[model samples]
Target: MSHTQTIPTRSSINPADTWDLTPLYRDLDAFEAEFSDAESQVNDLSSYRGKISLSPETLLSYLKAKDKQFLIIDRLYSYAFQTSDEDTANTQTQAMKNKTLSLYNRFFASIAWESPEILTLTPEILSDWYTKEPELTNYRHYLEDTLRQKAHTLSPREEEILSLSADMSYGPQTVFNMFNNADLRFPSIDDGNGNTVEVTHGRFISLMENPNRQVRKDAFEALYHTYDSYKNTLAAMYSSNVKKELFYTKARSYTSTMEAHLDCSNIPTKVYAQLIDTVHAFLPSMYRYVALRKKLLGVDELHMYDVYTPIIRYDSPYIPFDTAKEMVLEGLAPLGEDYLSLLKEGFDNRWIDIYENKGKRSGAYSTCVYGHHPYVLLNYQGNLDNVFTLAHEMGHSLHSCYTNRHQTYINSNYNIFVAEIASTCNEYILISHLLKKAETREEKAYLLNHLMDQFKGTLFRQTMFAEFEKITHEKEAKGEPLTCDTLCSIYSDLNKTYFGPDMIIDEEISMEWARIPHFYTPFYVYQYATGLSAAIAFGSRILSGEPSALDDYKKFLSGGCSMDCMDLLKSCGVDMTTSGPTSEALKVFDRYLTELESLF
Candidate 1:
């Protein structure tokens, strides 16, 4: 029998199996009512427009009102987006999602005056206001971070104009999403059993891990060939997106687009450069890992298609979604009882939408609604990898849960800089547990290979992507053209450099940049690399019984945007400013590679 998992339609699935979105709204009627309410609130925000700078009390009032408005808006968005994601082909839901997004953009444009108006206040005046209003202490960090960008902040009218155009700014990504998710179709190939299977974004990863190289290569070629056919359009979309970044940079008085993005989280450009530098310095480790993979696979020359396949295949059991939940609970036991209890509560309360159905969104993510439990969406496939994804996203869900419970709404939403730390920590912790509990050499080797893959994918590959982003941005800044051929050449060269001499850098891999959704969001991919480094270091400390490590980790989760990303990591005992964390993560990868070699 073929090892293919059949995906079902949304209507065919049990109601109990889907996420209970009631926490967000009672129904679409309630959602419509809330939408109207949100619009009214957006109109009301103008009342405080000219009054925010008057006094600390007025500022507090504005902040509180805005927070309330945002909460409703968030809930509305979460409901719409998640509902649409359940089945993208549902026209009604997609329309609702589009309307909600438009409302969100309008709300954002309405409040664009807040930042510029707040920035208008003198430092001493703002400090005096802080002293005058004790309640203002709750938003001190928020205000400070806003003021930190005062140099880039434009006049109130200009800021509002920019804010109103925010929806338009997401054009590139929106186009990519529509094309990749809804329109583009992949050709079917035989799964070695005389049965034809169509390629999908969700199933592509599974197909790559197939033992048959022909299937993997066919899938890779088909996926990229489709992307290549639209290379000119994609190139235009990506270039426009990069130029958009440049426009913001120039509009905000920033030196570069990268500086603009990093400054949002108050991260220095040095940190970004250091991440790339540190990873490049450890290229030999990655090269050795690739060499080992080639040796283990018995391939004379490893190609991009072979990268994801398991060298030492394990005859693992099909872990059902319920069993996966239990496994996550067991893997996370090291985090203490309260954490375990909360995890169980999430599993019990229908916080998750598990399994893939027709037109369902690919991959997993955890999103937040202020007054409710964090919601997670998963395309569970009854595999061990799916179990890890469960743990990873739950880490995000619980982080949101903890943050919302402790912090005010204004301080509740954490920055993306620390977002991946929580998720990847869960992944590493689970991997560590599974490694120790493996009953056979094959299992241990499989787990070890998984670790190596994580390092390669997250650390090395992301850094390479970061480099590509930096280069393309610089080229665009220097008035160089970013055509299809240019992007492919740049990306292809980086592939050769990273994969080393042993691996064949297929031309199809050049178009890989066009396929990545993250490239549209410049400087975002590097966080995964930085995040994994911090997670590995923190996981080591906690598992080794470092004092106050768990407490500090929990505190970091709860801190939300109350502190800068670096400070949050520092509080958790990993300083990202230096190369220490990245170096240590590389060392951990080396250790895993050694173990995998010994086991093999």
Candidate 2:
């Protein structure tokens, strides 16, 4: 992600760039027409109000019409937000984004009445509708889930009030983003010679991965020292967010806020709790990995920056975007020809915005709406990492494609718990493919190192984050003040335990939590660990051509939001409700560790 600052702004990027939104809509006028149609439909929602209970047919018509209306709103909001994230400085796009957020809020608020309205339906009537209409019966699961959230359901008016309170509710993410993105500045690192290089968030990880020991150490210290200066402010922002969760949880009649949050996705509280328990139980393995890192890196003591610096030899090679596209096709062939063909279509059809351009997004991700091909944003700079990133994002895109194609509009959107699976599966499949292509021992070891880094970051590091979040939330619930010292003490201790004793826990490591954007989003880290675990298990079986594994993997991608995540994975031969999937995946990690040692 380190850009050569010497080149001209947009001209520096590759000319073979793939992103052009013209295919989506001819121009602003076409999008405006769609926007107008959606607004008009929102205005027309009043017509179906009283007639909702008139008959099963009437109610179905209202819901169908409502779905279409909401889909339009979702598509508009999605496009705007995706665009905005790519470049925060574009004034026109920012205005469009703000308008889009406001409209989307209004759109959600407009429909807030429907849930409570539907909640009013007596069991007798709901049952009658189900029996009278088969399509209504198809939504039995949806209705039941809604009713399960009955206590959480505020009156329409209160829901509207809460919807309006979004800005205030978003104080944590907003404040943290500002501090992390705009306000905080790292100490300029002496990049050899007399010149100093400014450290940026996008470049932080890449710099940490630098082979130069001094560079890694300087970058790690400089970055955290910047965060340390604002630790108190960051702690306050985090406290506010935790309290927000507590308030919402208590406001809803759930036993705990964690349960309240997870219940919507039909995720059991045990899944979250089990991820913690399992990771905690396996602390020794993490410690052993740390010891190995210390030995392999040959550092007197490894610091936070040394952690990201590649321990094994890295054959850092450039992979062109076109070659990456073809590689993804071969890598993902296990998904079946139908899936591979769509993958090809997505590649050839300009579904991806390739190459780093001025004002383009910093990181990579896949986003698109129902009835549209999945869209990816990338600043692909012809690096091997970028190629793997392509595969990863495509996993998400293809997952979205399958779900959107198969499900009703209401069910088209899937949960984040399952979201990482498709993406990570693509990563695993890609690594397996690339490992075959490696012609040297160094190349093979480099891939293993990347694989371990992925596991350690997503699985182990996220578990650490999950622990930090759990500590803060519990402390907040007990009316404990989240002071800088208290927060840092808790976080730093976790760094020691998770990173194991061998890595030198520099003082700056304590400030690491302040920079994590995910901390604003509560109880969210556990999903990354669990999702990757499930993904590896599923992908491993499928790659080995296990009986029914491919079919099961397709079943999972096709589940959309219809089934709970655990049950969805159960169909894919991984029952994540138990800790078995994670432990099994960790066994694979252990095998990789063995491979890593063999390289030495």
Model 2 lDDT tens row, 172-223: 8766664564356567776644456766665667678778888888888888
Lowest summed lDDT window (length 10), candidate 1: 1-10
Error of 1 at 153 (Å): 0.4
Give the per-residue lDDT digits (tens) of candidate 1, residues 1-600. 555545688999988888999978999999999898787777788999789999899999989888888888888988999999998878899889888998889988998888988887877887888789989989888888888888889898999899988989988888877777767788887776767788887778878888899999999999999899999999999999999999999999899999999998888899889998888888888888899899989988899999998888788777888899889999999999989999999999999999788889888889988878888998887766788889999999999988988988888899988889888999999999998999988888888888898889899999999999999999999999999999999999999888898899988999999878888889999999999999888799889998988998999888888888788888778898888999899999888887777765
Which whole-number lDDT from 0 to 100 does residue 350 have in model 2? 76
Computed on alpha carbons, the lDDT of every model, listed in order, comes to 0.88, 0.78
Q: After superposition, how far is residue 142 of candidate 1 from its true place, in Å?
A: 1.2
**Candidate 1 residue runs with Cα over 4 Å from true position:** 1-6
Model 1 quality (TM-score): 0.97
Worst 10 residues of 2 by lDDT: 1-10
Candidate 2 regions off by >4 Å?
1-18, 32-43, 122-124, 182-197, 356-361
512, model 2: CA deviation in Å?
A: 2.0
Q: For candidate 2, give the lDDT.
A: 0.78
Q: Which residue pairs show collisions in model 2?
A: 86-361
